[model samples]
Target: MTATVAAPDKTRRLVFPFTAIVGQAEMKLALLLNVIDPKIGGVMIMGDRGTGKSTTIRALADLLPEIDVVAGDPFNSDPQDPELMSDEIREQIAQDLPITITQKKVPMVDLPLGATEDRVCGTIDIEKALSEGVKAFEPGLLAKANRGILYVDEVNLLDDHLVDVLLDSAASGWNTVEREGISIRHPARFVLVGSGNPEEGELRPQLLDRFGMHAEIHTVKEPNLRVQIVEQRAAFDQEPQLFSQKYQQEQIELQEQLIQAQKVLPEVYLDYELRLKISQVCSELDVDGLRGDIVTNRAAKALAAFEYRAVVTVDDIRRVITLCLRHRLRKDPLESIDSGYKVQKVFDRVFGLES
Candidate 1:
């Protein structure tokens, strides 16, 4: 009898298409909205382990178009956006040196659980300093993720100090490193995506409020849908290249839609009536800070951009309330209602179901 050998896994051959993912419509929408307008801050996705949380992030990264960057730039600074460039980088350009320009995939940096402060924010280059007696800086995960996405899986399990570092950078868009009397500051702006299971632990309120949107995903409960998901996974495992090829058209269409949304985003307008409505909704929910009101308005405008609409409609505001307000809700120990439910109730009362 001949022994059957298993085929080698070709997971590297292709990534699962963003458009091909099954279910989790809300999660997908939240991600896409941020992609269209990164000023929405970022998104936190909470759910079960096997419910495509990490996969959704990888697929979204793949779905995005490549970005043009200055060659050999550690921060991936945009050639067009000088404000985001480092002082060293600016000096090179000032000398009339020919900067090599190239296109690369948008960075998707993962902050592992055991990552140290030095590893994350980078430390001085000891080798260079020892060899030449010169002070030199080393780039870290935060620098690599500039103008891209920084993803943290199982974020709630991370150490509080590290979480504080991430939150500070996310809030200020600048990562300042001071060591041995030397200081370096650079642009650290990037979209933050955090995912974890709620049962494991809870995120700090201060860190949680930094995210512009929050989404909860769950396992597919329908038998037919589960079967379909399983079958698709099996097929992809068997022939990764072939499966990706099948979804090529769909992926292209989705990418085109994202590009269109970005172009249309600036044109989309938020009217006075809708602004009043957003304020009322936030007031009714009794959310603590003004972040809720600001995020809600940004989310509504993003939805309008995605739909290629120049005006914000009531439906657009309604669609984004839960995503924007879920994490910002005040904790009520005596009331065991879902945050999304509270948002919906307030939304219905303020806008009316007919509106």
Candidate 2:
């Protein structure tokens, strides 16, 4: 089998700054939360075309701080994360050899719509096998996405089998390839960001449930906000570098905040009472399983950390409850109510609006 990786667009020398995006606060927050605590699983962004879904994702990807990676490692394996490193790398570390370390742009790999399983997951190198009579593995998109974001546009339209593979890898934090009588496994942990148009197709329940948060966005209706978005795009189109330079300071500050949030995340505490409250809200919403409650707890803590707070609060839980449970709730065929509205109703009933 043969495959190719999605290369970054070189034309985009300066991505539209994340701080410059005019609207879609929920989408921005969900991305930021995942960055702070990748254990929050990933985010699913559902909206119509031209809703800034892709733009925001790419901008956020460019906004992130660069990461230190083990040089010559295809997976961007962290030197400290032994479990995620290959045996050869560990041996080099053990030998105290002159280990070359390098800084690399955090990976933001794209999963094109028609990509095959061999492209998403690694495959055997046929050329090396034929030339040298050796079995060698060529890493794919999943490997490239390690310790970074794997973006899938129009995710709902992807092949079901491919979706299953992606879901399994996201949940297990590893991808194992058994091709051409050769077996290989490596850490595939990544923050999965998927954007799709619900009008085209619906995502499978299993895959939907795996997403820690879901943000539903719509076109900006406010005339002024729409104008601001247009003006920004026009400026970006006219002079990408100049437009980026205008927001460089804000971008730097935002990056610093993300770094600080990661440092504070471990110290943020979630108490039992709040945990129980989160469960109560999930239970009231009739969420299918425990994942809703668990995700809410995790997202809340991450939100607090993003705010530089040491303790989780009722407000923190409320802020994230919608994103955590909106996609996980069991839908009522007879009811026309919005899922987000239903989540808010449950929140109000369980904890009250004032609380």
Candidate 3:
């Protein structure tokens, strides 16, 4: 699953290392699990502004190992996997033509707030197609994000319709564009990561529920930890290369760990009793749909895999259940209780853990 790409340009800017991030453990854990199993859907991170949300996500994308892609293909087409290939690549395969393979860093696409339907989903040149007798298609952000990560900052502020389009593509692993009866479909299997400041606004419950996991973060309050984070940032800014070098080994180790976890994920399993308990907790929480149950199960298994285990443990479920179910619980304007706390209380009761 890992590929080796050409050496990075020395002049390129260095990202803050993921392993070097100060705190926000919950956010980091949710992001890692999603990477391990994109089928778990994606993670919605709600936090205060300047809480390292964007920093951590960018570091994660930089942390991931390179991937194999078809040379000259805009979609990062996986030459060997049809599910991740573009229509043009499939046709080339059908003709039994040779494919040129290349390696590149996993793409990380930032979805802007003002992005239009055509900007995100690409456009079809109907006139060009009709006149030239060919498919005149321009690839979009979704195409560039294929087999990579699609990041939406301030997702809560994004238009609901745009959010729907992103979620639909994330879930279905494909994007279709139709214009003047000319249709084009391409693979768009990417981990959808969205981060926002809760103070701004909240996404519709329906759209929020579609995200696989939700991580809530706050500004670091500990003086020592805050000082350390600030110092680290200052150091990185002063000597980017030297600072990055200090944590290069840890980054490499984490990259290897993520790759191993992804490979081990398919073998990881959750017990039947645990499955029932997960559902029971969801039932008690009155979650609107089965998404909470499904995401919890998937995230627990992913955690087990991350730890190099084939069987899920209570600790695994305990760690991820809140992130998986917190946003799914119905909201009450008059109730001030934290949704995560409510989820934990229900989990402990259903799993027979002492409160």
Query: Lowest lDDT 10-mer window, candidate 3?
Result: 1-10
| Candidate rank order under lDDT | 3, 2, 1
lDDT by residue for model 2 (127-243), tens: 787789876888899999998999999999999899889878887888998866667788888899999999998898888998889999999999999898999899999998999
TM-score of each: 0.93, 0.93, 0.97
Most accurate candidate by lDDT: 3
RMSD from true fold, candidate 3: 2.1
Residue pairs that clash (backbone atoms under 3 angstroms), model 1: none
Stretches > 4 Å off in candidate 1: 1-12, 125-134
1 or 3: which has the higher lDDT? 3
**lDDT (tens digit, per residue) of candidate 1 on 78-158:** 776777777777777788666666677788899999999998998887677768887688889999999888999999999
Estimate the overall C-alpha local distance difference test score of candidate 1.
Answer: 0.87
Candidate 2: the clashing residue pairs are none
Model 3 stretches with alpha carbons more than 4 Å out = 1-10
lDDT of candidate 3 over 84-149, digit per residue (tens) = 999888888888887777788899999988999999999998889999999999999999999999
Candidate 1 lDDT at 299 equals: 90
